[model samples]
Target: MKKNYGYARVSSKEQNLDRQIEALTNYGINERDIITDKQSGKDFNRTGYVTLKNQLLRSGDTLVIKELDRLGRNMDMIKKEWQELQENRINIIVLDTPLLNTEGKSDLEKKLISNIVFELLSYMAEKERIKIKERQAEGIKKAKEKGKHLGRPKAKYPKLWEMYYFQWKSGQITAKECMEQLDLKRTTFYKLAKDYESKLIK
Candidate 1:
């Protein structure tokens, strides 16, 4: 027989899962068949989600969530996981988004519905990311206008860095010579060189 499983998530341990669990149960999912995770929606590393996806769910199993965010808040990651689950032939149903439910849908219907939802979701998520970046930039501008120091202080260059840096860049001196002069390891010398070169390019 095909099985149905419920996955519920709360962003933090202090938050209640009562609401999500209640909805899942009312949808006729067995209490024992529901897995709950008390963790951030930032990633899919939660114990419950991992176990539910890897261990419990099987081909033809239907996974239900109260909301799409319960799958994850990061849309990019959510879309990846969604694709994986579909590939594995597991059905998905979001209680709040009935259009995504695939339990009894034909294969063609499932593909069409998921594709449309994914595209719409990606568009919205990209817009949200842009808005967030714009808000952050505005905040930074205000802070700069107020003359507040932001970000880390620039890392000071080591002694005798300038002369050796030029020599290394011009290939007049080997990298080993530059590292030995600056008392830097090969990795550190190359990283500093890259950072310096990037600044020069800018």
Candidate 2:
């Protein structure tokens, strides 16, 4: 018998899987057949997804997902996986995009149309990602122009920084001892020392 399976994913452990689970269940997939992963969709190497693709799913089986992004965030990877599934003769049903469903697409013309649509969607997705990154870069540039600090705030210098720095510079204290006194790592201590010296020079 042809089995129906559902796959769902969340980007992080903090996100709940309840909505995906409910959607799959409502679509008539058995709760047991609904596989889920609490990990980013950046790749298809997710534990749940890998297990389902390699072991559970078979030819003639139907695989349902809430959306294309649920499968993966990488457009190229998503296209590759989709082609592999097609070669395996697995029917894919994307609930959010009905046109992507391949259940009733048996004719040559229909298949051609589906392929064209899939390629267009994949291209659009990739383009959208690029646009988002461009927007973020522009925003950062604007923020910098306005003198707004970017990235994590610099750590404050330790209370005994002046004393420890002078001792370290004068060779009276070892670098290790200075770091221990400031309760800082080697990198942080050196960074602070460099910044302090730069300020003194000014």
**Index of the highest-lDDT prediction:** 1
* TM-score, per-candidate, Cα-based: 0.67, 0.65
The number of the candidate with the highest TM-score is 1
Measured with C-alpha atoms, the lDDT of residue 173 in candidate 2 is 93
Query: Model 1: which residue pairs collide?
Result: none
Local distance difference test scores for all models: 0.88, 0.85
Ten residues in sequence with the least summed lDDT for candidate 2: 107-116
Q: What is the lDDT of residue 123 in candidate 1?
A: 92
**Residue 119 displacement in candidate 2 (angstroms):** 2.6
Candidate 2, lDDT over the whole model:
0.85
When summed lDDT is taken over every stretch of 10 residues in candidate 1, the lowest stretch is 37-46
Can you write out model 1's per-residue Cα lDDT over 30-84, one digit (the tens) per residue? Answer: 9999999888644546998999999999999999999887777678768888889
Q: List the residue pairs that clash in candidate 2.
A: none
